[model samples]
Target: MTLTTPEAPAGLPAPTTPGRGRGRSRRAGRADTRLPRARARRPLLFWPVTAAVTAFVLAFVAPFLVIVTNAFKTSADYRNNGPLSWPEEWNWDILADVWERVGFTQKLVNSVQISLGVVLIAVVLALFNAYALGIGRVRWRNAFLVFFLAVNVLPQEGMVYPVYYVFREVGLYDTKLGYTLLIGVVYSAFGTYLLTSVFAGFPRELLEAAALDGASRWTTLWRIVLPMSWPTLSVMCVFFFVWSWNEFLMPLVLLISGENQTVPLGLSVLQGQYSSDPTAMSAAALLGVVPMIAFFLVFQRTLTRGISAGAVK
Candidate 1:
């Protein structure tokens, strides 16, 4: 009887070598170690991203700070100090003066009334139009949709003169009602297109089911369509409201009198008419932004919700 041991081949380690197992163990350890280092490097790359966001935020907030500080100073103080510096004295006198001079209280009420009217009209028209184009049996719907989108591409100034002439011919100029109507007309096309897209994304089966349950078209729309489309409607309403409130150019040409003018138009007059007083102009500008800020604070949650819903399936 004989016993035999296997021979080691060339370019191969001997089976009895003491260091072979340790070498293999070390190789495995190195492979395992490389992964965590790669993972650790991921977070290190985020610093530039965070820095850019911080810079963007500062760029936006700085102008607001300058406006607020300038509003609290005397015209002389503004001349003496830098735009970013603190006011020597907390002078609210400019605010009072601007309010009285510009008739801010009356203008605020006018702006609110006009903007509300615009929102109501714009939302109603846009919803009906969207429903017709998106859900109802309509001929040339795609062509009309393209038309509406094309309307958004043109500058508003292109139509300003024609609109002004039409208003004048109809004797609707210089009235709050006229301004509201104009706002609705200008905003409807874009609104209709946006809302129609939203409507198209909704499940048609829900509407059909309601119809099978003996619901009328209008009933189904109010109950099923409108309810599910709340997020889109909310976003549109907020957008229209803010834009109408802040609209300056159209109102300036259309509403000639200070009494009928919106807040933005009145603020422009304040800036121009008080060119000698920087403090007063700054105070008026600050006052003008207060309503917008208040609105954002109140509806910011709805805004975020709407955006999230619109983006997700």
Candidate 2:
């Protein structure tokens, strides 16, 4: 009696025991209904996503394509046809002509000078300011941060009058030197705000360890923090460079001399009041964007790595 297995009631016909086949059939039936719904639901999601991505891609790429196609086209071809149509013959002379007419070499040099100057000044200022606010945890740091945010909030339009007046007074109104300093300081506001957040999240244990080793704060910063944050700083530098490079309104207002003008200002030569050269304009546009695009492509991997490495830290 103690060893006896439990038995079902006879009248219940042994509880109508089902074999693996019956259970398998039930599961298969459930899967049949579920799988079809899942399969049907997939296309519903996939198609919309594909369509949206395609729309966005075309929206962005279509203009670039137009620029590139028109860049190599002859004036007659561009005028006879349109921007979207392929060029009948590739007139490579447009680039050389546009280059010489606009003094592109000088303009590009000006752009590089301004961009590099801005990057160095802005990144350094941002790093130091971020360190003080984020790592040092200075008094009223939040207030200081708010001030930086406020600076960024003021649109260029609002500051233009005052800036123009001040620069005029200083006799820097039409100089590359003035533009570099002005744009660098202006761009640093955002960089300070961005780097502050990154610095605030820096590992405390590392700081403590450095202190234990008798490394001064300044020493620790360069020797340790700087390297750790190099990826982030590199990313920020790229942003500042691109921002200052593409600066239009400020350059337009300040740089009156053709020799002093940055790359963006050179685009003016492509257009005229009475008539504009569409092909030449396209060529200039193509040339203008090439450097920045190349810069971004080079740093794209660093940005991705910085973000991923940051998550772990």
Candidate 3:
């Protein structure tokens, strides 16, 4: 005997399987749960972080705004309207006047020479010192490193008088080359310490492989280590350059001649015993900082990579 199964009601849809219904319900429920969580998280997490970062950036940029805006204003406008106010009239001539009257053109050349010299000398010395301490297996390396750290921590004021006397006796005082040497020696201590860490973290396997291939220590350092360490070296160069450029105390003491003065010294000449030109000084300052800003922009990526690489080990 054959039996017929019951059919669905006319005009009604066929029923879905239990598994299909369950899956649809589960998916719908999950979507419903996720949508609310995402909506809730938006206000609680993302917006606040964005606002904080924006505020921090604005705060950081506020000073540059003051410097740039006031740089174009006249001294009267600066004094009457205050530092934060917009300029009544732009005195674009102040920049040219600063360049000529303050002898900034000559001072800039002096600064470039001194700063480049310091960076060159410091980097070369630091590289040799770091390689000796880190890769050459030199005895008493820790003691040497400690001595450098000690020198780095010593106050510049403590050594200034003695340095002045010595430079004068050696007939090196008030000379740009003398100041360059002084800054190079002073900054090399920190550079040595920084590069030592980078070198010590060098891959042991590579050094061993180079040794196996009969590479001498100098060859390994020059070919293998230096090529790999260019980022850190570039960072050191930027640091030393910036420091030498901005250094006022050493330049003030070591360089006395108007012709030999750097940008900072030239800017000081803008001030008088009683009165000062705020607008021209601002222009000079803006000019003075441009090279540093340009340098950082050019090397920013390398600087970041160097810092991150050094931090890794």
The TM-score leader among the candidates is 3
* Model 1, runs deviating above 4 Å: 1-39
Candidate 2: the clashing residue pairs are none
Better of 1 and 2 by TM-score: 1
lDDT score of residue 212 within candidate 2: 99
* All-Cα superposition RMSD per candidate: 6.3, 4.8, 3.8
- Cα deviation of 35 in candidate 2 (Å)? 5.5
- Best-to-worst lDDT order: 2, 3, 1
lDDT of 1 by residue, 1-313 (tens): 9966688899997676578889999999999999999999988888988999999999999888889999999877788886778999999778888899989998999999988899889889888989999888489999989998987787878878998999999999899999899788668889999988877767878888988999997998898989888898899889999999988888888999888987886667655543557677778899999999999999999999999998998
What's the distance in Å from true for residue 173, model 2? 3.3
- Candidate that scores best on lDDT: 2
Per-residue lDDT tens digits of candidate 3, residues 181-248? Answer: 88898788998998898788789999999999999989998899999998889889989989899999
TM-score of each: 0.86, 0.85, 0.88
- Regions of candidate 3 where Cα sits further than 4 Å from its true position: 1-28, 311-313
Model 2 per-residue lDDT at 155: 93
Model 2, TM vs. native: 0.85
Question: Which lDDT value does model 3 have at 308?
Answer: 88
Name the 10 consecutive residues with the lowest summed lDDT in model 3: 3-12
Q: Candidate 1, residue 10: CA error in Å?
A: 47
